[model samples]
Target chain A: MGNLLEIKNLNVQFDIFGAHVQAVRGVSFELNVGETLAIVGESGSGKSVTSKAIMGLIPNPPGKITSGEIFFDGSDLVKYSQKQMQKIRGKDISMIFQDPMTALNPTMKIGKQIMEGLIKHQNLSKNEAKTKAAELLKLVGIPNPDKRLDEYPHQFSGGMRQRVVIAIALACNPKILIADEPTTALDVTIQAQILDLMRDIQKKTGTAIILITHDLGVVANLAQRVAVMYGGKIVETGTLEEIFYNPKHPYTWGLLSSMPKLHAKTDKLLAIPGTPPDLSDPPKGCPFAPRCPHAMKVCVDHMPDYTKLSATQKTACWLLDERAPKVDPPATIGVGGE
Target chain B: MDESREKLLQVKNLKKYFKVSRKDTLKAVDDVTFDVYKGETFGLVGESGCGKSTTGRTIIRLYEPTEGEVLFDGEEIGGKLSTKAKKNLSRRMQMIFQDPYASLNPRMMVKDIIAEGLDIHHLVKSDKERMDRVYHLLETVGLNREHANRYPHEFSGGQRQRIGIARALAVDPDFIIADEPISALDVSIQAQVVNLLQELQEQQGLTFLFIAHDLSMVKHISDRVGVMYLGNMAELAPSDELYDHPLHPYTQALLSAIPVADPKVERTRERIILQGDVPSPVDPPSGCRFRTRCPFAMEICAKARPKWHEAGKGHWVSCHLHDDGLKK
Candidate 1:
């Protein structure tokens, strides 16, 4: 009901060499309490950058949140100092990184890794942290938590290591959990297990989640709401049903249609022509205009404002405008069989 | 359509075991058998450590077959052959690796990377001919002549993959082993590569052994699909029949495991989440390799290997549940 995190026009940039790469261009979204909001996009679509900016994990030298505000818990996180962010990071907002294989420290014991956050954030004693760490491991469906605590990361399988990563993120019992491609590296069956675990954990803890992924299937499985991002901007934001069944943006359509349904009858996929625009010299107007089939002259010349389609759905496309020609979506766009 | 066509490649009891240590051997592709029709994409789907990639590599002669026969064009190509025969085999059967960035030579220009096959086989006559062929190959894969002069670093992931396709096509191979070719590319870009592969297959009459973990894409492109688990072929049938009426427990579990990109379907559909992870490849489960994780695993599944026999018309499966003799 209440907004847990509100990101308003967040802009992140990387000054590599002399050219400036606009990673996140005026992105805005809100995460409601105890809701799963998935940010779906390809690589370099600014989903990860936006999540990193929320946690103050952006490296200052090359990468910086150049503009915009990250309002979390009624405070502007944008103005927060490094020391201030460090205290709030593990305690109130926790993150499960992209790659579980490299996320955990290979040399450190799994118990110590989980306990580090607990001790630092909750100010728990060494013995208390150890007990809590074991409990967290068991909660994440790891077998023999007490015995497994002493094991190193390499000793665990890929799926078990990911469970350990989740345990660490859940160690402090943070109010908000940000999982970035948590199941990408795992197999589909293992991914299904992890997704089920996350859902069960969310139901128990009531922790709001920001799930960043490229796989739309994973999004459909876990997320209640979806944000379609392309070329450093959020092109469409809607409820899961709206995005999957009634999408507006051409990029969203392309993304949905590009992937074949498991029982898809079509022989060829309706692939979006060309590639994503270079961030260093991004397009003048809509980022997806180059690849969009319904791109009008106005689309290339100027960016379209977000048109409110429904109470929960909004899209930034010239096709949604009243004056623009009404173009119907492809017959194969909707994912469901019916 | 497939029965009438000749078999381009027949893999009979193919085995590729790697000696991890003196005692332990990793059976990467143990006694895997399948046939690729003259002009069809034979999709091989499996999870990680399932030996799909190893099977593809073994067929292309990247890794020598530890045991078994690989008959390509009615000739026994798997056995030890002369250097000239090996060279000729390499030209006839090309490979496109998974990682486009790592597969392509970063040091060399795109022209040279694509022309490497041409240079190796001495397909071109002169300097002009080599350059011309390189340019033509680049265009064939949707890239321009200008891109040939540039290095691999300058291209995007999708472009690099296109370049990889160009390199494979440079030799004009009859069969191509595309091992996870579109896995590295973006979601939107993956379709482009898939469409490109389909077009190339149609135009050139190329027979492909499409190896990937992505089930949906495999079903879309492949004519006949094979399911593999722990270096063993679980099921093999036409793509439609394989997906619609999967007989093997492993194949059914695998098909259900995939998350479809539909909110209504994903929310309502029941998923068969297999307990535990895939066992270590060094020492896989005995008898039926899938028995450990299979929900419908019977007692006999652990005692003896299931016979790899035809379940339905053209649908081959290896499972005790499908074994009529065992059922009796």
Candidate 2:
């Protein structure tokens, strides 16, 4: 249960034109051996950039990790050279992207596309990789793997294409899997199937998972720990129960209340007031001050420090400041219990 | 209620089939029937390629039906109507498309986009009147009057959707078919759009056919709901009744798949994970289209299509398991 990956004070910026767009600003978290950590946020949040930094996939010249130390299995990934990082990418750590249609090669057969990773990373023979490729397809629940493996990517449906993508990510038996919005483009029924498959695979293989999604429902059902991101910062970090039931940050409250639920009966949902902060030129004070319902005079002047709610929960909000008034979420949301 | 006031729009045995190949036919909307009461939201929920969108589009005559009738205000659309009668009918029915980015013309300004409908119907007399009406419509959807000069690219996804709503309201339509209006928006912005739609519906006394893929949002906005599967209506009931007591196996499976945000509730609820994928519409299986994945599927399910019958006072289901005319 020791830390498998620890990120400290991560800062990622992009040089758009002449100004620097600070996307990920001083974010930190830890992922244990076999636990699932979900990073939840809206579109422009830096959840994707932090994971991209770990995989060394950020395009340079415009993008740069200004400061941070990404420690993976007692080794610093930020300090690794391109050649060194290449060895660890697919062999030790794997990532599955959001859109499977664009991820897979449309012209190549499904079997060859999956076997390329095995051949390149594990140095398996042509015949050996082909046989193992079929096994991987079968493992991911694709029927008649032997016959379907030779078909091109366009022949498979959207859900099956995603399954093939999952099989590729699992081919090398990597210790960590980073899935970024794997079910965003899928239908709800297919999304449920994929979520179930990921959970089942994590249980069987004990692979530490980092699921990056905008879906709060997925985080509630899947992740052991949750990190709420806003304006490229971890505004809140806690277990699923603490984040959902007893959210301290106003942004987290907006997220929970904005989510359309099956049981809630109301004609108009309580939408958050304003848009996400512009990342190109972020505000000097609290990033979420404009949209926060409980904004104070001090909140507009200074950024809040991270306040620890418990050993496992911490939130960065001025309302959580000791001198600030004790503000609770709406009465209907209730406290952190059933 | 009387029959005239009970139904705002009634679609009977609606069919929109496409000739895929020389002999093969795709039943995109096969024998579907439903009614949208006046001033109520009728939700249609289904998976992709399940003909939910097709049904909505056909109702507005975007795709002409091969058979069946679409009656809006007690008059059959696409029937032998006089030229004046057709003109009056066009002003009463309108549709809001799925993608706001694609639905709005890129070249047109916000003012012109909203005025296009008014210009088509010649509802406005002068330039000043049209400009004032367009500005008023903008304010109605919570957009500022200054947005009239801007283009679609100038606004965010949510703002663009507000502009789309403004255009739909310009004609002053009585019935609106909102096809996944909030699906492309961000989660934070989705609530804003849904709330706006509900507010507008209430203020305008508009009948809506809200089509979406998410059951949670569907349950929030809809008064009555219909579940479609492979071009057929699988179940139809009141929103609260369907959520509490889902009868059809497909509907039960869909409801169970929705992930509740509470950990304790999620742990207590059992997820019904259906086996296999949805069959291709080009060559769907015989009888029940969901028989390939239905856990309670039987031999009769594969032999013939189940007859749509009322299982309760208002709840309707089309499955052989509940065809005995006995309420579950």
TM-score, chain B only, every model?
Answer: 0.98, 0.96
- Which lDDT tens digits does candidate 2 get at residues B1-328? 2245578888899988999999899988888988889988999999998999999988887787888988987878845667777677768887888898899999999999999989989999999999999999999999999999999999988899999999999999999999999998889899999999999988999989999998999999998999999999999999999999998999999999988777777778788988778887878899988899999888888998898888886788999899894333
Best-performing candidate as measured by lDDT: 1
Q: Per-residue lDDT for A261-318 in model 1, tens only?
A: 7866887899989989999998899999988898899989899999999999999999
CAPRI quality band, candidate 1: high
Clash list (residue pairs), candidate 1 = none
Candidate 1 wrong stretches, greater than 4 Å: A335-337
Q: After best superposition, candidate 2 residue A285: deviation in angstroms?
A: 1.4
- Could you give the fnat of all candidates in order? 0.81, 0.68
True contacts kept of 1: 0.81
lDDT scores of the candidates, listed in order: 0.92, 0.89
Instruction: Assess every candidate by TM-score.
Output: 0.99, 0.97
Candidate 2: pairs in clash: none
lDDT of 1 by residue, B1-328 (tens): 3467899999999999999999999999999888999889999999999999999999888899999999999999999999999999999999998999899988999999999989999999999999999998888889999997899999999999999999999999999999999999999999999999999998999999999999999999998999999999999999999999998877887888888898888878888889998888898998999999998888888899999998888899999998989764
lDDT of 2 by residue, A23-135 (tens): 99999999999999999998889999989999998889799999999999898999998999999887788998999989899999999999988999999999999999999
Best by DockQ: 1
Off by over 4 Å in 2: A17-19, A335-338, B1-5, B80-86, B325-328
